[model samples]
Target: MKELRADIERAGLDTLSGRKAPRARVLLIAGRPGSGRSALAGELVRQVADRYPDGVLRARLSEPDGTRVPVGRAARELLDALEAPAPAGAAEDELGEALRTALADRRVLLLLDDAADAEQVDALLPDNPDCLAVVVSAGPLTGIADVRPCTLGGLDTKSAVEVLSRFTGSVRVTVDPRAAERLAEQCQGQPAALVLAGGWLAARPKAAVADLAGQLNADLGQGTVVGRVLRLVHASLPASAARTLRLLSLAPAGLVDPHTAAALAGCSVESARATLDDFVAHGLLHPVGGSSSPQYEVPCCLHPLLSALARDHERPAELQLARARMLERTVRLLQSCRAITETDSLRAREKLLEMPRSLRFPGPRAAADWLRVRRPALLASARLAVADGELDTLARRLMSQLVRAMVAHFGTRAAASDLYDVHGLVLDVAERRNLPRERAAALLNLGDLDARTGRTADALGRYRTALDAGREANDPYATGRAMESVGGAHLELGDYDRAADWFGRALTERLARGEGEDAARLYGRIGAAHTYAGRYGEALRNWRAAVAGHRRNGDVAAQARALSELARVQEYAGRLDESLRTCQEAVEWAGRAEDTRLQAALHLRLADSFQHLGDPASAALHRGTAERMLAEEALEEDSEPEHGANACEIRSSSAEE
Candidate 1:
């Protein structure tokens, strides 16, 4: 690899080391599509990674289909790689600022690969002179200052021959050195072409090097060397392998696992695995991921060729069918992925048992590992399905399962950014199909994420729109949810009167639907909103209602919480004796609920109320009890085994129900 671009590597390293600019040193590795610029940049990163003690970060600025990835999305990807918090629904400029701030003090290496233009790279460049950004683009970054483009071309003949030998072996190249050189020349020393040619030779072991060279020379047409070589290799594949190769184009983002391949090709997992391995052997596919569960990536240079093959050989209907089948299979996998975490649920276990062994994850850890590894491709699958505009049912199923699986494994907060995007896709499908119920659902989800990320105004807009859609669909559940969400958004924005009104509306809906628990939650929300607005009388009434509702539902913990709120409202109303009585009642309920934390908190409240009522002895006694309760709870927590902690803890939204 060093022999292939030793000079370029040396020059890049020198430039990065010598620079002390106001911003990151920018190095542009410009090349044609198949000239191995990405590979060379990767090699340079490997060579100089130690210089940057912070870390190395990479992001692809363009998708496999040449679509320019949005700058905000790219920045989010980089932040995720850094394990930094990136707010959902942030503008591109904000995300860019965040990215720069993240790298401002750190000596890091940023590999901005396959960038579309100067602006794309500039948006992501850090302001730290100690950092370096090596950008791989198809052409010069015209607008950037103080940077020179290192243009890459085909490899030199000697290095090309070495690359070839790694695939075809040395014996063939050594026995017929002239033919090997001719074959390398025919490939024009392009690494992509060389690999394909080498694979072709490797496949036909008995055939002389001259034979493939003659075939390529005869087949030279109005196309790229890589294209011609890909055609030749593809043409030589056995029927099953050829079909698998063509179907691989359907894999999202050119990322394929055996299960996806199996689904697309309508074959068994074992058969698909064998065909994939064969493609790897012939350089038609590149092995990625770990050896434990191997995945493959189709080379971007070959995407067009494979796509053309699929278009020519496969019917449109057949292609659509294949896509639908792939999505359905993905849904099932996601189901199993989430179900594996429900260890206590017999229904989940039954679902897992019904699935094929290959589709089921061994346990929650393995499921999470698989989800992490496949996140990019799985997201791509959802995006592509939505963009297809013809598979709304399958797309909806795929997205629903995707969201649940992410929440099950990564929790909502950790996965909020991705969830935001998926919810947008869901909205797109809902709008296109004119499905008001689904639209309302999607909007509510997006609003929840927006609220979590502190975009309360945006969340308010979404929730209001969702409310309209729910009303149009006459879905009481959705309508109630939208009302509560809007109220939560209003509460966050400090519009407490409007928040209370909306929460009251949601409470009415819940009551009419006989949802006692939800009604109790909404009553608490209304009470909180009233308290925030300094309406103590209204707050006390709502809190009393909340307490009564929870009692009717036999929810002792909720009743205890409601009663504690009532005590605070009573104190706000200057009813000190009433506050004391409410606190004592809350403490009793907390004890009955077996919620030690709540019990301790209520005792503290009781102590404050006793002190306010001028009862020193009772105040001192309750304070002592509260402290003892807390201390015992702490000891119990310390004694618990470390592994008992659930890694897949789902975080609830901070927004009131």
Candidate 2:
């Protein structure tokens, strides 16, 4: 704390805006794991916590294995700690507002420990300048503004000796002070290593400290000080305890609750809990606070040792078996989670129900809670499983199930980027296995995601690949979808002529397959492209054909949609009376379809047509009706964007069909 204080004073103050102000309200303490960064941050908070009357709040922002805690999850934790009520499934930005609002009037000391990066800290910063945030992280957290950085190295020899004496007896250190100093030197001044050495000595009260030091020097010839001390600590444990410790390296996110530990160790949850508690007591693992279950994690410095030990002692088959169990358990949990969110889709619900239920969640809430906590680990597992080609087909199947579940819970747009990596993995597998149908499906999905994110060029490229794969697989449905996507991408890029050509090709295919409804939708897409290109004659013909097809298919809503597009083309062609008549009939169709939003938007279009015909009173009446309907209920209006002040509007809503 004293050293940090000196650095803080050196950082000085800021005088921006012609006024003196403290340089930073946030302090960053960066160090390696097991270097006592958390302890240092805690001490700093203790020294100045009383300065902020609202109280101090500390949050762990990453798992031990270094997966960043999702921003939404982190915000939820902060709001919960602040006693602020947050709506369920709130977005990350919404949760951020809730956190900032809760902290707005309070002068608080916030300690964000084990932060993965600066973004995590930035999202959780309070709006109030009176609040202070002390962020602890392994990284330097560069490029963040107004941060006072305190980098922690190993402890000094004096502090190290005191730590050892506190853990061991002072008399033991007093008897052979030189040997004690040598032991601290061997520890490389790391507090964790020193404590482990102390615990080793404390466990054996009569053992000579000098002899143990010599033994370590002889046994661990070229190893790091941390590695040497960890070996000694791990070696002293019982066989079962040591085995459990090694298997814990397989634990997801390096976080081990009782149930997870039991799966890894093939034991009962109660027994695993007791074993973890014993490790906590002996300082082999640190107990995580603010968690519902009694959880413990091996220190990061010691984690590598556990991994190496597991690889050396555990058989390959044993490791694989354990991993499979964890994956299977995760798959079952995701199935339940995806099932609960699929209330509207019967096909998706049936798929979820057909999945084997080796594990069961008590309710939907429990299922959602588990998925929220374990999403990172589940994704990590999916990537690893896909990369490991020798694994069973169950791994790939699990990945598919997980992707479906996440997309069901979060909308496609919200979850697109999160699922992109997994989609890439699936594509790789399909290409490697020479499965043309799967490859086409994967490419189509990726192209759709790219289009949604505004990557028009990339989307077009992927769609081309999908089209070729679909043709190779002799799948007409895939081919039609790919063609449509390519046309949509062209439309997004403002290449309306090319878009119209591709939509024509797709429409031909749908008509040949007797898909009348889809053919109607494709015709509407073609009409939109022509309208965008200022080709009113071609646009009018395609839209008329679209309306006839929709009427033949008995689709009242779709006929209303097609008629709305036809009205815009008619208005563009200097036929105000015809346009006004088409819009009126379109409004009647929308009413029959019970689509209030579409009805209101058509009324507005009617008003536009009337005004163009030089009739102010009729225009005003239609405009008033549209406004009244829009205000009565929450609805989204779809209408053409008006071209050059008096020209016709070009509606592209049919492109979504």
Candidate 3:
């Protein structure tokens, strides 16, 4: 035991002053393991020994199992301290009276260590003013009504370092003060870790405390003090709370809404909420920022502990089940976010019908806020599923919904990064399942999103991967989609030849299948790439073929797209009459298709066409229509066919469309 020489000397005041000067009636010393609780109590006993003529009394009221020590046993010890003989079968009430009567007019001192509870100490407390009582326990005896209590946690930094210095020797701790401080912090202010860590470093006194802290941190897994602490805390929790805490540790964003918590825990919201506060009281979590709705985040200090606990305690099947629940909840939220945004979408209406009544978030804004805050956690969860192995399918499904939600809300930077991560995971899942069609689909989506976000190189890589996957499956539709994405990426990268080659390949396959919308889209893309390369005649021909195919297939958005490309080609060809005619036809097609942005652009083109045709009044009228439509977006908002394509800029007012 480390001598308590310093603290012992300071405890001198315990004996010198009595009740005549408002004496120290209670000397409550409490601390964690190896923190001198016994030593401090011993020194205080020595200071007050002279006044207590009846002599000192000591009682231990704890079992290793934490079951409370019986009050009768404690009473017996107290009676013995009073030199009162009691029969072995004495009842607790009789012993308590005998102890109180014995100390009624005498000065006495009591030291009760590792006490079990209030009742154990109640019988030992001296009743007279001439007595001093000391109590020590791991927790504050909150159930105790009368006696003042002192509960111990950990030593403060200075005292803790001082305690460590006793072992490491003064020179080392004094030499590098800052490293010593960080060592204390890494110990998590726990005296046991500090002492163990100090002993670890002190054995090799030449070693830096910082170096030891680093090495110890690197090795802080199942065998570490931190690990044991989690095991104990986890084992100490109720079965239900322990399960919930494990599942919640897997939450990506740290903060969770009550519904998500319920979904993750497989419990009612009220139950999950109660569990949440229980953790908070134990200093395991803290409140998260923002309150578009209120949220609570698990503290970082507790995260590693929770993680270790989950890894150690949760069986694979149990953890997988928990993950499934959280993902199911995520998919529901993603669908909800989409549904609440699009007023006329039948899919949206149907999704809403399927939503659980307890699917919370008071309003659309509230839901958005929740998503914003929990975004990191959700994304991290997706990553974790893939990393956990055998969870490929779950990860794929999770990423699909996650990408949709990310696209609908959040910035390009965040969404693009998320898209890349999900797409990467999707490949692994597809490979494992031997689902080439699904692989192609995943790659195509990732590539398309990448191209839209201006990540041309990344887009090309994904597109080529999709092409390979499609060829392996011998799936013509998947292959055609892959080619189209590759063409788009090449066009963005200024590789006109490569773009045209891929587009032609996609077009031939689509034609063989007699899929006109598929054909129209490829033809329009080829036309655009040709136009970008200044190949006017080829662009015009491809655009005309695209327009004819789109019109025959009743593909309104495709028709408008082809018309816009053809008009641009005609305008660039320096044929004023042909350009004017094409621009007017483009406007007619856009109007027919209810393509707002295309219509607006066509109006502006018409203004240019009229100016070239020497009609100033007509040009002015077209210009106003174009400007008004561009500003209001009334045509687009009211348009029945607002397609998901990169043809127009979508301005998300929030993370929602």
Candidate 4:
């Protein structure tokens, strides 16, 4: 790339090197679809990245279908790259501000690729003068000030021939220099066209450059040099390989793997893989990275041609069926990805056995790695399926599996932002299909994510809607869950009275359904709301009920925690003796529960109570015991051997009755 794109690369580097501007240095790399703008931008970053010192942040500003990526989503992605927190459900302006703030003090390089317009680029530009931004688009950014676009065109004749040599050996090029030059000229010095022509020659060792050049000269079709060359090369493929190439266009984001290709083409994985590699040899696809799974990317320049071919040769129903197969395959893979993590579930293990070996993950780590790498494509698949509109059932299943896979691998909190989007998609499907149960579930999930991200008001609205939907669907679990969530949101908003009211309503639902444990938890929530409202008498009653319920359930840990809360409220209500007795009982329960930390905390509370009562000797003894317990706990933690410096493990478990 450095040799072929020498002039543009040098100019871009020079523009980036000059940091004397008042704001971030902006260099726009504008070109046609296959002019290699992305490749050049990457090379420039590779050369000048160290000079920035902070880091280089890259984002694609458009979807593969030419739709503009929302400014908020783009900002959130950049913020994620910076390892900065982006609040879920945040407005575009707020996220933009957060992004600018994150880049303010850092000397970072921003590579905004495939930008749709000047506004998209402007919104994400860092305010810091020390930063630099390279914007890649198909045309000049008209609104950005003092910025000159480094416009790209086809490669030079010499460079075009060199590109050909890389695919076809130099010996072939050296043998027929004139014919190579003629072929390069016929390609209009376009790198993509040259590569395709070279791949054609490389595939047939007996065919000379003159043979291809003569063929192109005689067969002048009604298109650009690239289009004509592509048609010729595509026409030369075996029937199976040609169909595989056409189906590759259906791949989300133009990213294809053997499994996806096989599903799309109705072939075996090995056959799909061979066809993909063969496409790579023909310059129709580019291998992504040197991964064992072998993913390929359809070049941006050729995507339209392939899609056109598919439309011409494939029936609409056939295309839809192929898409359905791909999505179904994706859903199963996601199911296996998540099920692999449930190592303790015999049902999950049995499900894993039922799946084909190609679909199953080796272990949790490999499953997580696959999920992380395939996340973008997976997300794109959901969006595409939803937009198709006719496949709502498949869309729902895909989103459900995607959400579960993400949560199983990345945790709820870490994946909240993405889950928020998936839940919205679910809501879209549910509303369109008019399915009350699914609508309620989607709303509940969205509300939960909103609450986790501190959007209390938004969460409150979603919860209320979910409650209505749940009741309409006669779903007791969803209704009860929604009521509880509403109470929690009210608590977060400091409306303690309303929170308590909602908790009571939810408690009634739980009790009526004979859900004892959930009813007990609701008692604790009601107590908390009452305590916050300074209703100590009511708080005491509720806390006592919670403690009794936990005792009945034989949950010593819960009982101890409940007793501690009851003691606090008792002390608040001036029943010092009762508080002291409650604290002692809590200590006993904690000990029985084998909760050393809770026991230590209870002992400290006992010490405080004794000190307030003027029993100096008892207070001192309790304090000493508490200190010894904590010290012993710390020693136990220190005695454990350390793993490797970077070694960390995340274990997730489900609760058992």
Report the Cα lDDT for residue 340, model 1: 95
TM-score for all predictions? 0.93, 0.72, 0.59, 0.92
Cα error, candidate 2, residue 244 (Å): 3.5
- In model 3, where do residues sit more than 4 Å from their true spots? 1-237, 242-249, 253-265, 292-294, 301-316, 410-414, 449-458, 532-535, 555-561, 589-600, 613-657
Ranked by TM-score, top first = 1, 4, 2, 3
What CA RMSD would you report for each candidate? 4.4, 8.2, 25.0, 5.6
Output the TM-score of candidate 2.
0.72
- The parts of candidate 2 lying over 4 Å away from their true place are 11-33, 37-189, 194-241, 257-259, 268-298, 344-358, 362-365, 392-395, 635-657
- Checking candidate 2 for backbone clashes, the offending pairs are none
| Tens digits of lDDT, candidate 3, 23-105 | 22554565654454655677767865886787788876753224466676577656755666444334578767777777777
All models: lDDT? Answer: 0.87, 0.77, 0.69, 0.86
Error of 4 at 652 (Å): 31
lDDT of 4 by residue, 1-657 (tens): 344334323444335677444557788889987788888888888887897889999898987667789999999988988889688777899999999999989999899989999999999998886788888999989988767788889888899999999988899899999999999999988778888998999999989989999989988878778888988898898888888888888999778999899999999888888888888888888888845456888887788888888998999999999999999999999999999999899999999999999898888988888788777789889999999999999999999999999988887767888898899999999999888899999999988878877889999999999999999999999999999999999999999999999999999999998888889889989999999899998999899899988988888888888898898788778899999999899889989988777787778777778877888789888888888987998988866433332121111111110
Which sequence of candidate numbers ranks them by lDDT, best first?
1, 4, 2, 3
lDDT by residue (tens digit), candidate 1, 38-139 = 888898899888988998999989887788889999999999988886898788999999999999889998999889988998999999878888889999
Model 3 gets an lDDT of: 0.69
* Higher-scoring candidate on lDDT, 3 or 4: 4
